[model samples]
Target: MTFRLTFCSLIALAAASPALAEPVFNRIASFATLDNMAGDEDRTRATSAEIMTATPDGKRLIYSDSPLGAIGLIDIADPRAPKPLGNIAMDGEPTTTVVLGDTAFVGVNTSESYAKPSGVLRSVDLAGGQVVANCDLGGQPDSVALSPKGDMIAVAIENERDEEVNDGAIPQLPAGFVLRLPVKDGQVDCAGKQVIELTGLAGIAPDDPEPEYVDFNAQGDLVVTMQENNHIVVIGADGAVASHFSAGSVDLDGIDTDKDGKLDFTGSLKAVPREPDTVAWLDNDHFATANEGDWQGGSRGFTIWNRDGSVVHESGPAFEHALVRIGHYPEGRSGKKGAEPEAVKYAEFDGARLLFVGSERGSAIGVYDVADPSAPVLRQILPSGIGPEGLVAIPGRNLFASANETDLGEDGGARAHVMIYERAEGTPAYPTIASQDLLGWGALSGLTLDPADSSVLFAVSDSAYKNQPAIYRIQAGSPATITDKIVISKDGKPAETIDLEGIAADGKGGFWLASEGNPEKEIPHQILHVDGKGAVQQQVALPEDLTAGSTRFGLEGIAMAGDGMLWMAVQREWKDDPKGQTKLLSFDPATGEWSGVRYPLESGEGWVGLSELAIHDERLYLIERDNLIGPAAKLKQVTSVALQGLKPAPLGGALPLVEKRVERDLIPDLQQWNGYVQDKVEGMAIAPDGTVWTVTDNDGVDDASGETFLWSFTLGTQTAAK
Candidate 1:
């Protein structure tokens, strides 16, 4: 079962597959880490799934939950519907786990402080959830790997340094090393322990070698990454250092280098250190490193190297740029590690050698074809849960899983999740919308169909990019493509102090935009008209009486009604409105008059509000959702109000209430990708063919998974407005 690739054979395979359909991976299910908690435990408590391994039968998944001080188990009998198997308390922080037969070997760090590092290698029986054996390792462990023969285990003792001590500079006491143990009869042989010193191997800190990740090849050779030291070491099967070398550096160009809330990929860096994090063997002779720089450098990509430490190929910034095209670039991390490729795994499925690279910050996984290691081709980018930290492939079942370590449940955000994917003969289901070119775009808050073209639509961003407000033109198709960008400009410069939340085509090569405003910030709630060239033509502020009762949640969506009146959906109730009711304000540009009607909202567990508005066939459609994500999400739906009998009341008075009808429940639509339900259903548009399209904002990749979903469907028997 050994997989090997040569330069000539890889090139031949690349040119061999045009007639047959290639297998693609699509997410099938997601298991939240909190689900393993008992009924008596607080559900809001944070939990995580950091590193994971599957049983030899591939029927269950075991992951390290450091926050919970346990290893959680999952029953994957039905890979598409994973079930929780509860958690096994390890009495200490479990760092990594590897399974052989029905036993899981986990590295548990019991270190009280960085100065005194201590850990134990615990072997737990998966069937009974009991610790069967334990062996003292005499150091804090980070990574645990089982040999391909299942007879030996290797652990990386990462006696990590405290960042508060001298700003985390290395050369701290208690240098780390590698430990190897033999396994006999499905149990660790405690008496057969070997320690291999890794000190004096890295240029950055020769005395303190913090081993981050370890992996064993088929020949029982182990490859270890010293992340903080920016070095790599290979240990032979005989428990000795075979070879070691510096992980080296890379020069990056055309990258976003600032943390200024805008995505501008025009910066460059010289001689950036490729402080590799995770290394996985592509074959017996080649390996890949995830260059997630922890100290002085992070090249923001992955690299392939020969077993002798020579560079086989360098991805440079191509991997990060690929994420930019799909709207997953984390602008907030531009000044640090862009996407932060932190996890790498290599596997052969049905003769196709594949490499999986996980981005911790961007929350996505890049799938590469490594049949040709020197020129690996990116197959697809799969959306993982926030902060994917571990990846494991089960080629026996055509499945793969990622353990996301970030848990923000205490802050009312998404919890850590273990996402499962299956390989089959089908096209990729992600990246439903992407830029036609390498365009950095996100935070799509509003959408409007073009007046003259059914296949063309427009979208606008909110305050995510404060200084670079933009409108994007999209060509509607199976996977929608962003074709062009129009930066909203005023006085020959990009407009500032504007939070564009909605857009509507103005019929005459122009558009009207709804700008949500915060009074505290002095950004007025107003509407602006922009020409085809995106130059501001006019601005209209809300009446004084309306502004007097305005809150921060104002003017979310805008639409042009059939009667030549502009309609807007106020996100939440204002000071003068009744509870559970928001305003559907209207403006008559012909007479410069303002009026409004109230829109009823559904009561839910969290605050509910309107996010988008659209008009079709004399009906005003609205996107209504609650401010909850993951399993707590509810009330994401599309509702419509008939405008035929609608009447508006004068401002600063009792507004008329409009009756609404539920058209669709978007929760199921959001669940089609099998990830968590996104919170913001911010954009919607109706095409001439009666198709309804919607998009979810990614919050500009700020503390979010950075996944923007654009999908479309049609209401049965509905005709386009004539």
Candidate 2:
């Protein structure tokens, strides 16, 4: 292990973790959008919640689910316990929606092809879940916005081009326009529509004029963003063009520019276009845009612009840096758009003006105090569901919600969800563990407490960082934090090809690590002994007989017991084992002999297997969980076997089965974090005072919220309640 200490990074880490105070926003509950897939809505199929608006009374929510081609509603009367009302099929792709009174104005795209585009604006009665009226928009519509008095409805009819056709170039369309329609009784009059021409108003692709998103100011004027054209335009309420300007570029510095399994915010980029999306009006003369670059531009941040085509405030790389500091950086998109800021929401809560910025890639919402629109102060960042593509702030209920769009259910992953947060007089509870804005760490698969100091803990990274696997030292405070890093090396290079999943303290001020094997990835199940300097002291490969019929699943956890004995928890039922049983293997350094006892597995939905094991209070504790998430998650708990009657027989010949009992049901504890249940609860460590600390791996921020939850609870022997 090599310590690459840098003074600048150390200072950055110390200054980034903010201690939240009054009016803190904490996530109270999360509801899976798939729950309301009723009637023809298949439960196992994909669903999403995007572009939503809440009722004036803040009691109802309406959102466009593009994948399901429907608009879904939610009842949040209790706010903390949200219930799905139902989903109304729109017969086409519902892109966006806005609610005025109990009526929702939705934009439905029914285009057969980009060259022959067509769409309609449908007004739906919320109470009856019925489409009341349809106005042919003459083109594909994107964002739907309403005026302050709800008398005028503005829609950006973007006859969007086909990306697959000649690399998604602009000027390939029947030009788009901003359509303004008079609203009467919450219904848009199709005959009384005026299309404001938006051509020749941009520096890039001015002929194409593809309107991406639209919003209306308090003065009843429309502000539209032409994302692919890299421009912005403001049109008066009378359908006259007020002003237009290029949504210019930015010079970004100190950013991680490569997907190299490292969070190095020290790179630079110049003249990067801020092709913004999801525009929101902050005031009569000011508005904000999420720079979710589409084709030619994406500045990787958010921007505030003045109505007169001048920049107000640019959040260069601050928001992205903050995400990196919190271990939420999307390493997969480091080269494309790091933490792509895609959506913005503005609200005034009790006189405190708030701006919510959603990073689609980072999967977190940044809450900024925008009282001074020029210099918005970031107060807190709340974790949301996987991809926060849409958001709404209900000031009436002191609540904020996000519509996460990505669903990975087919792979047994987290489904799309609408998460809720409330501003209360308490601390933020989601990030049980935190890191300084400079420490790039996640996929925490292994943990071990320091023998001398429990507050000082060590953790290991899995293959998420396939290019740079290393170890981290953590300070387990009120909100546990990572303090130091040590890269395990061999031959003076990063030992990153192996997936390190289990760790144990060696009596000689070092550690013993278990590297899980994946034959597909050409990794072997091996054990290693490293000294305090991170140098490999000894290495042992699995015996040929035991490795003969091995599958991908391998050793998941390791623990040091008595004398020179080291125990390991195999992840699943490997070859030669019974259908529902896995082995707890033990190895002696003096004898180099391997013995094991069969651990009977409990049947559950999905595959039941072990994630972690720890020796505490004369008992061997195990984290047994099913490979399922969200509402499908059925098993995630801690069970233990007594050390009093433990005896390991020879591995090959009918090993004795060990008796196990439930010690803790971690489902409630995981739910206490107020998010969807993550599938990988892969690490556990015990302090000398009987405090058990556990963590879940975040898959290296890939297809995840990039949150590594680290929390502890006291464990007392308790029988299974069921």
Candidate 3:
């Protein structure tokens, strides 16, 4: 199998091969951590679902909630719809959890400060939600695992260093170690504890070993990853170190190594350390690590290693590059840790041995068929919530779950969530659109259909890539493929400071783009005309009278009307307009004259505004949405204004208001994917055959899940309700 296959090629392979047409994972439900809070509790407080584990029957999932200092439970009796079972408060911050029979062993941190670290292992009864036992661990705990035969439990005591002190350098004293205890008849024997010292094992931090994650293979051998030390240690069932080796390093090529507000994959990294985070076994002989770098290094991918620490295979930049093709690359984190592979899990289902690699920054999971551990094949990339920290697979029930630990609800963003996916007989439903030929793309703000071919479309990036504004030519299909990219240039260089939000194709091999401006930033609100080669030919700024009333929420969409006029949609109301009405401005190139009319907006909890515009079949279509995400999202829909009787008034005067009829409520369409409802429905275009295409803005994967959805639908000719 080829290693450099793009995401589209993988999908095509799965579709073409009968043997490969097996059950694929598709997200079926998402449970928000906020739902576990009591009705009287402050829902505004932060919460998280980090490390997770499932019951033997796979009917329940338990995850550690560090912020809430509790363990959250979810009942998955019906895999399609997960229900929150509330949370059980712990003595301190919960770090990890593992289920053995009806008991859950959780590691909790109760440290007062970095100098005085303390932790405990608590055993809870799953049915009654009560702590049954507690064992003092003498240090901060990070990861916990159960033995294969359920006869032993292991915990990684990571008395981690304080980054603020001496820049988080190691040898901070009170060296870390691993704890092993026996399990008797579904109960923890706290008194039968054994300590395995890890000092003098790593070259980087020999004394202060910070063990990040721990796992057990089928033979009860434990694998521990000391991330900051860049070392891996394996212990036998008798609690003796069997093998220890440095996680080593790799030289990365064809990667984006800077956070300069653009996606440039021409850079390279030399001798980057593979500071492994989560370690999981593929069998007794081989294991894998998510090389999530710490303070010094992170190789931006995963590594397959033998028990003796020899490299079986190194992903290098392939995993991160694969994410780049799917628009999940975290450009904002490029300078620090690109895509940050932080979690790994190995599971077998129906004779297929698979490995799941989770990207902490990119918020995606790369699935691979690792039947031949020496050469793993890239299978699919699954989208998760922001900051996927934990993954659990229950082969018994053919279900998998990811614990996303980032919660921005207090700031009106998506809350932490546990997304559940079920393996069934169908194709993967994610990655509705992807780029080919390694073309990195995201933040799709506007789209335009080609006049010559309805199956071809064009899209533009917003200010997310202000330094490298580009136009992407797309092949509009079931899973849209970006075939080409043209950088918008001025004076033989990439344009700068342009916040392109809308695009319209010119009949004569050119495009009309609407740039949404920020007055405070001095990015002018203007319309630009670019030729087929993406060279700026002309720029038209708003009139002084109109600019006087403008704010940052300026022009969002532009469309060429049938009457040879360019119509642009202003996102929100300006100072000169009445509340709940935004402008629909028209420009006649023949006369260079500007006119305008107001479009009424729907009443909603958050501010509603226009994001895109398209003119088709004598009707002007617009995407109207509120600035809310997840379950709070409402009013994401396509609305239309009939152009037959529409009239415009002159600028700096009383503008006529046009009535809008709702064409399609897009909230249902977004919900069909079974993920959180995205806030930015920023791009839409209509094919000549009346098909309506839409795309979402991922905000350049900054404080976002970076999941782009490109879907299409057709509407009937009947009149819609206003």
Q: Pick the candidate with the highest TM-score.
A: 3
Clashing pairs in 2: 1-534, 254-265, 325-437
Which candidate would rank higher by TM-score, 2 or 3? 3
Predicted candidate 2 versus true structure: per-residue lDDT over 457-567, tens digit per residue: 898888888776777888886557777777777777777557899999886799999989877777888888887767777888877778766788899999988566888
In model 3, pairs of residues that clash are 293-298
> Candidate 2, TM-score vs. the true structure?
0.95
lDDT of 3 at 159: 89
- Report RMSD for candidate 1: 4.3
lDDT of model 2 at residue 711? 83
Per-residue lDDT for 483-559 in model 1, tens only? 89899999999988899999999999999999998998999999999999899999999998898988999899999
What's model 2's overall lDDT?
A: 0.85
Model 1: residues >4 Å from true position, as ranges? 1-20, 716-722
Candidate 1 lDDT for residue 421: 98
> Which pairs clash in the backbone of model 1?
none
Once model 3 is optimally superposed onto the true structure by TM-score, how far is the C-alpha of residue 193 displaced, in angstroms?
A: 0.8
Candidate 2, superposed: residue stretches over 4 Å from native: 1-20, 39-41, 717-722
Regions of model 3 farther than 4 Å from truth: 1-4, 13-20, 717-722
lDDT of 1: 0.90
Find the candidate with the highest lDDT and give its number.
Answer: 3
